[model samples]
Target: MTRLLNEEIIKKLVTMHDANRIIDQTFQGFGNKTVINPSKVSLDLGETGGYPFHEGFVNAMPAYIGDMDLAGIKWVSGIAGERREAGLPYISAMILLLDPRMGEFISVMEGTYISNLRTGAQTANSLKYLGFKDKVSIGMYGAGEQARFQLEAIADLYEITELRVWNHRRETAEIYANEMKQYVSGETIICNPEEGEKAAQAEILITVTNAQEPILLREWIKPGTVVFPMGSFQEVDDDLILSVDKIIVDHPDQALNRGALKKLHKEGRVTEENIFTTLGQLAIGAVEMPNFQEEIIMCIPIGTGAMDVSIAGHVYKRALEQGLGENYSFINYN
Candidate 1:
């Protein structure tokens, strides 16, 4: 029998704290070289006859965690603008959990919720292992679903004094500010387009936008601020990438193939040598901690399949314990 779970069932099975704990183990697995997370392959969906698929892409990510005995793959699609225009979710994903012993499929689960939650939990783990001030101020560049989760995780970890938001759409930012008040103890200011600097003044700056080009400048970044660019595309300037005292990543291969570092690597300006260390190394104490009070750091947290599989495996076990999901016989023993 194979278990089948949907988004609602997944929510009941896992919490943000659960995500944080699982992703922490995933990072440690990477540090200890017990995880196999191959670089994800992307299929670009070019313009398809009247459909807005020019910017659409599907990614296949697979990973295995040795210590936890977890293995799985996530197939996810990103069609932001087109889906948003049609009032549909911009991101969709599915996770398939596999038996480690015989490579049998055991569970099929919705992945969007897990993906978003793990992303935020990964950031929280970064802050925890890297260190952060007790009272934190966050500068958010996008007001989307990811931004909300990021705030939720951060708020749970620290006392948020202020949140400065700047979205390309002013109305969207305004609405986000009002709705996100539950996560903040202080104030949420909606920065104007011309006030990107004001929004960048914080202990942590997160860029979760879909901008194809750089919207954040090097000058806007302050000392001691940790910048997190969560998009698959470039959202911060080259100078900022070069000027950061330290750059951390989830996977060096994926970092060199995607995000702001990828473009810089192609131009012969950045290389694997320039990467200070991986989040895993930092999490496992394999590397020296940065002078976080005086130096700026860039932590590029690219999505990893190891995280998806680990989280999904945990969820599958929880579902079995709670008797939550439907189980159907996919293999007949006649």
Candidate 2:
């Protein structure tokens, strides 16, 4: 029998806290050599004109965790400009879990929420391990769905003193600020062009935009600041990338291929030598945090299959225990 869980059921079964723990455990498994994650496979569709000339892509991510005895693959789709034109999310994904022992399909669940929560948890975990201990202000470069999840997860873990937000569209920033006021007790500032520096000055800065060019500059960042560029495209310049005190990534290979540093990687401005350590190493105590005089640290996470499968496995168990999903047979026993 296969359990089929929808987004609502997955949401009911999993919380931000659960996602955080699951991601931590997944990283621990990676450190302990108990998780197998392959390079993600993606198929790009060039100007398909499906939604009036929009580009899109389909990606497949597969992983197995020995400790949890779980295996799964996430199939994800992304269509550019869908949100603005059609009011649809930019990305949609689903996960198929298989029994690790017999290779039998066990369950299927929505992966969009899992991706959001796990991505947020990854940042929260990075902040917990690598950020300043004192309460600090947070700055968001993009006010979108991913930014909302990042704020929610971070709020659950840290005591935020203030929030500063800027977006390409002021209306989006205003909407995000209004909605996030309930979560942030401190003041929320909607930044203007002149006041954009305020967001960059925050003790913790997070960039979640799908920009092709850099939006954050090295001059704007301050000492003792931690930055997270969480988008798939470039959001920070090479100067900022080269000037950071240390660079930490979820996975070296994936990070090098995408996010803020991809251009730098291609230009040979940054390499493996520039990376201080991976999040897994920090999670499992494989490497010590650098004791550097420079106070700026940047962490980048390109969402991984391990994170997806780990969260999926956790949600699957909880859904079964709580009787939240419908069960259907995938194979016939004759």
The candidate maximizing lDDT is: 1
Q: Give the per-residue Cα lDDT of candidate 2 at 9.
A: 86
What tens digits encode model 2's per-residue C-alpha lDDT throughout 64-83? 98878899999998876644
Provide TM-scores for the models: 0.95, 0.93
lDDT tens digits, residue span 158-248, model 1? 7889999999988999999998899899988899877888899888999998887898999988788999988878899999999999889
**Model 1 residue 298 lDDT score:** 92
Off by over 4 Å in 2: 47-54, 81-84, 291-293
Q: How close is candidate 1 to the true structure, as a TM-score?
A: 0.95
Cα RMSD of predicted structure 1: 2.1
Pairs that collide, model 2: none
Listed per candidate, the RMSD to the true structure in angstroms reads: 2.1, 2.4
Query: Best candidate, TM-score-wise?
Result: 1
